[model samples]
Target: MASLLLPIAAAFLLLRVILSATVIDDLRNLRPPPDFNSTIARNCHHNPSLRYCGNSRPLDEIFKFTIVASHLCNESRNPNCVESFDKIDLRGRPKIAPLYLSFDFFWKFCPLTIRSIDFSNNSLRGEFPTSVLACAQAEAIDFSHNELSGDFPVERLASMVNLTVLNLSYNHFSECKLSESLVFRRFNSSNFVHSGLIPNKQSFAVKAVFLMIGLPVMVILTVGFIAMMCFRRRNLSLETPQLRHHFTTSMLKAATSGFSSENLEEKSDGVDIYRGILRDGTHVRIEIYWSNISTEGMRKFIEECEVLVQLRHKNLVRVFGWCDDQELRAIVTKWTDRESLEMWLIERAPPLKHRLKVLAGVMEGMCYLHKSWPQVGYDLGTSSIILSENLEPLISRFEFDGRNSSAKSKFVYKHKFGVLLLEMITDRGKMGDVEAGKAGFIEHIRTSFTANWQNLLDERIMIASTTMEQARQAIEIGLACIDHSANEQLNMDWIRHILLRIYRASCHVNGSPTHGRFDGDRDKRHKHGP
Candidate 1:
């Protein structure tokens, strides 16, 4: 009994030594309430030292506790280290106790209360801790930019139903390529390189579409608005008066779900768009204007909106209605389940056939817009173009017209106009020498830039002998549309003929007899020897 009592006393003393060990209380002072407002800081790693310290406001005191488990953390021979719960940084400041024993102690602890865990940009080693399996509430995890090895255990990740954002950027995840089905479920690819996870074809296309189309168009509409101010001096007299559409600030707030962050789209010219669904089961895209709108310009914008709403061409985006009451002005268009054409194109693989099809639809739409309306210069470039389910092109945002009906003047106009046409032809608007031009009026326009198209062709369009001629013809039409002299520019009537000829050439190359179904008149013309 004496021996047993002595052993028990020894164990009790060991426990006391651990429990009585001094902890740096100042560290605990950094704890914040669990409800820190999260603003998605993109590419947060850009400034690696810029630490995002969480709200230092303390959580309920009851949530605070310390356990003397440091001795158990002695997995290595490093004698200086203490056994304790693993410390995880919330934002930048360290919180959550150090891991006791192996990191597996995480399973025994934080699986319940912790909602977000960010272990990014650290020298964290080992495979992703399987202990996270117990984290039912773990919705967002940032394990990117770490020294983690091994394949991305996707099977384990997919099990986390609550996970909304999984950032796995800057890690050695190369062997673990993710499926299209996987990325489709995940939203943001915050730092997707080095993951070795090539997204499947469909996902690649979708992601490309989002980046290429969504980003470029957004940048153009945004930057073009500013760049276009330079042209204002030339067309000062041609400015149209905006129409009035007024709405109260209260109505605007209600429509936008109190201007929630989730609804927010791109911010341009002090305008914020919210993905708003109206009470009438109508999908209303809400755009809140911060800049001043002249009454005449507003009126003209409304008239254009109304005009577009009336048209039902296959390649045209249908506008439902506009609401301008109080301080809000919103336009309701038909809700497309598939996001945008730009988004679609950005994520898709390089295919000449698909590119041709997209151009053809856009050309058909432009033909209708210019010819059917007469005197209207359907300015369907850049931001105005969209894509459909079959990857067909659909034009949008045609409300803002240049207000100039006459032919363009000066070489600079020719260059800008040429770049615009090049985008339609090559599907790559990343302008370079082809757009900048060398010398003279012809050089400023695309008509003189045949060499540029050869360079700018998206590498995805495989160099197939079959599709070369059709692609060349398409390029020719784009050049024709942006002739140096405005009078030299082919009319839409003639442009449509060129487009049909290109389409016919594509059909011949592919030997696709089904092409006739798309154009009964073309089939008739062929039969009647056009």
Candidate 2:
């Protein structure tokens, strides 16, 4: 008995030693480092057995998702159970086929694990589940071609800060609550298609794609474009009249009346405005558009200046050149001593007939910019537009945004400005009862007036059109040019044609009277006349 016990003890000791030497350290080393943000919660399914998943050793070898799906659907015996995918390596796979994984079971396994969800054409029924809102980082949600009902749960979705696109097409959400903010409301009705929600053209997916694909390409293109522009501008600057003058600091000092306050036209955006004479004694206005801007700030301003330099039109105000020598920065433009139309309307009681003539000239200038030279609006409103010695209006101060290279036209900004013009003309030179330069004065004009043509027409101009149908046509066309929809607004080309007809008819209708008046008032009002 003693001999048998000794041999058994020896054998047990040997086995224990071998197991410790071979397996224990290997198992300790093989343990996975923890991932704190893993999709553990998403793997909860309608399965009780998967509750033990937390205890599984060699955990990487087990599929929590497959286990939950089988447990929920009671498909442990099915050959094509989600378990089939358990052994398949899914890393770096570019495509996910929806049919292979039953979405019902997929939801059961992990509802919020996905970053993108395209459940379109699923024939899924019922209201859009609020549970999906749990997916905080979801970027796109496509529920199109389904049977979803009820108003869009905007309140719930407001929490999804990163959600950029929400497609509910071919559904029944007719009276859904929506965000009225421009960022939210910019989407069109077409995104709600076939009684479903239509995606906005500026949808997150499109914007992201633009950012990811189009934006980088755009940046590359922009860099190349700006480089070429800088090269061309350098060449053009050498040939410009302002550069040819070879203006010296002393020359600028002498021209600016020693930078006197009396010569200052107006203070704007920290810029000092001075009426200057060039070295050749050519009169020109100089605006020392200065800022204590950081290096980045200066770059942005210079970029804007570069964009402005490309534009050329008679109706548009031209920047001759800029000076950035040393700590000083300045901009120069053609100076008109007559000032803006706004100043004239305020100070001088230019008669209604003369005012109409000024307005006609304004329209002519706008027509040339919008149609003839074929740049949209130069953003020329009352301030940017200058009047000549005879009160002829000229549009000025053309600006462009280099950052927005894809902006095809300035139609939207121009149409709003046109509406303001309508209000200005109709208000009979009386800007408002409010004090001049008050905030919201311009905005009040925009909002207070009705968009209807009759309501917007100036009573003064209305009297001018009486018994002159052609003048009436001119007023009608001017109103049309300011229509809110850019497509509906008349381009300068169409406006020019209309003005030609109006001119011809004016000659036929009031030609005799105008001629008679011209002959009578020739010496008093006009130096030269029929």
Candidate 3:
């Protein structure tokens, strides 16, 4: 009994020590109240110091905590040392909402440790206080269920690195800009439903389409109003008009159910690939943490995003937009459930006609890439080409580094395309198949093809009717492109023309459908003499 009593006494003393620090916690009535002595915050081996003090400063006797909960923070040791104050809930108290003076007090005394602040359901009115940014290290801020109005400075919000938790829903903002590269992972279209925010993609496209069609009609009806509108639009600095809405990491999590294993398709170091469905019922694949935002990296990536969004072609995969969040970075691209071209090659041994179409499409896309972004290189392997529902091959990867960066050569990309064609034409035993030699994929192709050129056509295609000769022609051109030693090598332009001819001939001979069926008369000029 004596031993047990001594242990109980020590426990009681520890409890008293914790409860005494609850002075500020009472005024706000924190929900699921924080544990000041939360063992998790003490992950660091070093002893917590008193340099910044552990007690939150009292504003006054009545409303004691106006400043910040910076006491438990020890940045040098545990980076998450201050998450105990993760959420400062001064909610449900209508009187607290209108106190701009209290907000200023928060700014002056805040030790930059707060991550979340909840002031929802306070019946707060008027503009969102600029002082809310006072929690300089804020991660989550809730201003929902209020009557706030005016512009939502989303561009300004982009500066916050870990600002993942946010809800400005049920507000009356006149304008919300979605043009910034920061895609709130969740899109949260419902959050801004009644808030009068225009999504970037529809906002720009709709306006352009409306202006093009409506302007002529409006001009004929009333020229003066048209002139006024045109002048105003030119002067208005309204979000610069983006054609696609950037998605945030939060929106992605919601779409992918917090990137659950079921939705995760691939997991690599610091990178993850997921399958997601957009609000519009579009299927997409998200590659998360694509790469770290190194020095001047965000700017370069933004440029890449701008460039990628503008590329429109049948052979290239569609990129919706990119996320530049500090915690997680990702790129969103249109996706389908179809197998990649390599899979089609290995498993189904796609027909000669399908193979020809793949080659033609890949070459066409590469040509467009060279013309559109000559400085960039097409990035891919055998598995990089995915066959769409219609059997059209789409090049799913490309990379654009800085101008001085090595990935900036049209010729190099052309050579790469040639190697791809060679790979497609042969059955290399595996997707990334290699010969018994130490020679790399490219080197093996160069030497092997030169040695036994005749048996090179994949056995799958060798038996393919009527298109076999055409397949041979494609192989010849591919060899010439990769043969750098040749004085007169095949350029992509001539290659494109020849492949187009072969595709037409193969279609005519096999009665092969165009696009899997072509237009009227079937380009009879490309047909061979019977």
Best by lDDT: 3
User: If scored against the real structure, what TM-score would every candidate get?
Assistant: 0.43, 0.41, 0.50
Q: Who is ahead in TM-score, 2 or 3?
A: 3
lDDT of 2 by residue, 1-530 (tens): 01222233334435545767642223223222243113333333333244323544334322323333333222213355332222221212222222223334234334233456555666665677555555566766666676777666666666777777766668875453334222344334444576434344456578888779987888999999999989977788566634542344555668887888877877978788888877666678777856777777667666555544555654456665566555567767778777787777666644344554555566656645544444333555677778875556677655543312122353554454455344445553454565455234444444554454344445655555533354346455544545445324345444444444444445445443452212332233211110
Please give the CA lDDT of all the candidate structures. 0.52, 0.51, 0.63
Error of 3 at 384 (Å): 1.2
Worst 10 residues of 3 by lDDT: 59-68
Q: If ranked by TM-score, best first, what sequence of candidates would result?
A: 3, 1, 2
Model 3 ranges off by over 4 Å = 1-239, 403-408, 430-452, 485-489, 513-530
Error of 1 at 91 (Å): 84
Task: After the best TM-score superposition of candidate 2, give how far the Cα of residue 4 lies from its true spot, in angstroms.
Answer: 99
